[model samples]
Target: MNKAMICFLLLLSSPVIAQKQKTVDSKINHVTVFLSRAQIEREVRTQVEAGKTDLIITGLTSQLDQQSIQVAGKGNFIILGITHQQNYLSELNTPRSLRILKDSVEFFQKQLLIEQSQKEILNKEEQMLLSNQKIGGTNQNLTVAELKGMADFYRTRLGEIVIARMKHDDKIKKINERLTKVQQQIQTQNELYTRNTSEIVVSISADAPATVQLDVNYIVANAGWQPLYDLRALNTKAPVQLNYKANVYQSTGEEWKNVKLKLSTANPNQGGLKPELYAWYLDFDQPIYRGLQGKASGVRIKSAAPAMAMDKEEDAMEPPAETTADFVSTVQTSLNTVFDIALPYTVSSSNKPTLVDIRKQELKSDYLYSVAPKLDADAFLMARIVGWEELSLLPGEANVFFEGTFVTKTFIDPNNIKDTLSISLGRDKRIVVKREKLKDFSSRKAIGSKQSDSYAYAISVRNAKTEAIKIIVEDQVPVSQNTQIEVTATELNNANYTQETGKLIWEMTVQPNETRKVVYKFDVKYPKGKIIPAL
Candidate 1:
């Protein structure tokens, strides 16, 4: 055969060079998958023509599964299958097909790489932007608004490229800020974790009870730090101002004033995130009070008058019967008994009588009388006595009463009496009685592990006066499961007290200008695993 004829015959017989074909047979009973039938036929034909049985079967199965096809029987001697699988062989072996596949893969890879790089760049830019924002007012840095605008502009021009970058950058900035904050917190916590020790010296007044158990605690770095020493009550309810001077050693002294000093019955909570009682800063340098001293006195006197005179002749002496009938002779005779008669009567010296001087003389003498300024209690008592006298004066007895106001004489003790000057008098004249009411009394610690648990508390009683006063402290404890109350004092004890039906009675007798401390204790037990809300 000629060369051209041989080539043409070979090409006509080649399965890879066959024309496209299709067939449908109702009797074959095969699943028809709606896919590129021409493409599948081309792939199958090319593999078969290459003398690869494995390739043909692999391609056929791959296409079938991808297109969701069902095969009824694998081995079937049918010309329809051969023709359908042989079509489109030339299309599958074309150079253009190979080139298109290569281009698709390269395009995908480039797209993935570009996305990744954009994300990285965005992350870096975001970190820079956040850093600049943190710097805020630095002169050489771009403002946050400008940087954000730039990012937005790039994003709009670059489609998803800018968006990926911005998101990556924002994530990085957030992570960095979080990490920095965590590191700072850790450093601060480490600095605060050291064990500290201090000595608290409390100097109480001599008039105070010889012993007192003061409940004290402090706050260190937002943590409750309790005192190591056990405050034992030496004298309960002693008459004195508790001048607490705590000297903490090896500690910051300023923190002491910030500590909460509670004199309550409940044991204080030592470890917690919340404060049981708000801590108060004490200013120890400030003077509590100024010292002022003054002296006062009161006096009383009786008078002597002619109405009670012993001279009956003078009283009976009638007026002269006539103006000239021995008037001088009658007067001389009448005065002869009262006067010496040897010397003519004349006023020796004019001396005005003063009740104060007379009272001073009486004070010097020993008599059944007491003298004190009529101020406060003493004054009240004096007024009561004078009122009684006014109501009980005898008839025609020539009684004399003086309504004298008090005067305060301020001077050095060793100074002369004449040098004493009056500072103030009759200022507080409303029969002053100062009384204090317990505004609020609570425990500095929770009764149970959580705030939901009920607890008992105590309050100190202070009477700012120079007289004995009585006070009654009463309160009801919050009722809950496994709760009990106890009130202890030097004078009274209320162990049976309950919130439902009990009253703690304290008949406290506070001395003049004194502070009295008292305590009430209670307990509350709650169920396990229960969280109490913040109060």
Candidate 2:
């Protein structure tokens, strides 16, 4: 019994064998970029000997989400578990481009140091000469010719020293400028120059010597894409050309070199609208000695379509869109959209915008000049786009170009339910518009218990272009909210008037070098004691 116990104790105290560890390098093969984050997928292949092998995948960015790490492999091995940690002793490997930038910064810094050192030496020499300027050490036995020769020597040397000092200072200034530029380049690139090291360790068990291929993916932060557009109109009669684009960027340290990219509109960082509720047991407040008994009831909400705040822009989900001709294939799912880019792209680790062309479309539009003379004398050219919603576009700022000239910027809002999208193409100074009050028709009178005020205005629009143009002129009258106040339009000049809004609209076509004028009058009557501010 004593020998058996001794053998068991020795067996329990023995050290367990450690697993063989191996460092594996992975290549980024695919990336799916969202509106605020990105998912990176990599392919790792390595050989594993028989037994438990620990594979450490290195070179990931510090902005990676540890909870999103997932690994799957194909071989005669079973994945036991996975863990993530930082290798504090070492950092990420420097890429060639960033190393070049660092070398440039170092070179400039060295040159600056040399120039500054030269300047300092020259200053010290000048100071030393100036402090020792007691000719012949205060002795009167020195000859005048010797003194004069010494003076000449001192003057020439001092002048040369000044010139040399100025030259050195100038060189230092130039070197400093170069140094600042290179440093800014490094900061602006914002690539894999971080000092933190990230590693994902995977524990696996294998039967025999086998080669394993790993499919590893994880979600990373500080990577996203935004919508950008360019709207161009070559002529008033031609269709508007819409160029949809995206500015994709990522600051995740690993560079995606020649990888497949798919843009997604879904943001994983945001919580979903659907929430689950479990059954709850309700009981009255009481101290009971018996077993607790209650009825269970709960509201089992659906997986989607929960109650949300009535923010039209955020809540109006996009319907299906007709896929058109483009290099990207749009796949619409229930919650979000996926745009598969056809070509392999090389998006650097630098957080700089890389312009990606989404698609180009020619949209049908109607152009009309809009003049609000009462507000401003400028007649704006407006374009009513017909079918912009079918493109599955987001609300983004657009650069407007009219007649091959760059105009002002406009925003395309997809939230509105209007069938046509209205965008201002800019003002047409060639079409002059003017509005003036008619003093002859303006008067104020009081009769009985009411006071009446009459006002009139005249507006003129001149078409100076070579072709005819259609314009919509707008004006308004006073709107009365009180029962004692009465507002009437005396003359509308054949304009369409809406009584509810007191708006007057005139649609007309003006030929080249033609002028059109309209005069309208209105009267407002209110109680004698009440004041009408709008009048």
Best by TM-score: 2
Which prediction has the highest lDDT against the true structure?
Answer: 2
The whole-model lDDT of each prediction reads 0.28, 0.83
lDDT of 1 by residue, 59-172 (tens): 111112122121222221112221113222221111232345445545545555565677777567756655554433556688689879877865564655556667756665
TM-scores for candidates 1 onward, in order = 0.15, 0.79
Q: In candidate 1, residue 26 scores what lDDT?
A: 16
Error of 2 at 224 (Å): 1.4
What count of clashes does model 2 give? Answer: 0
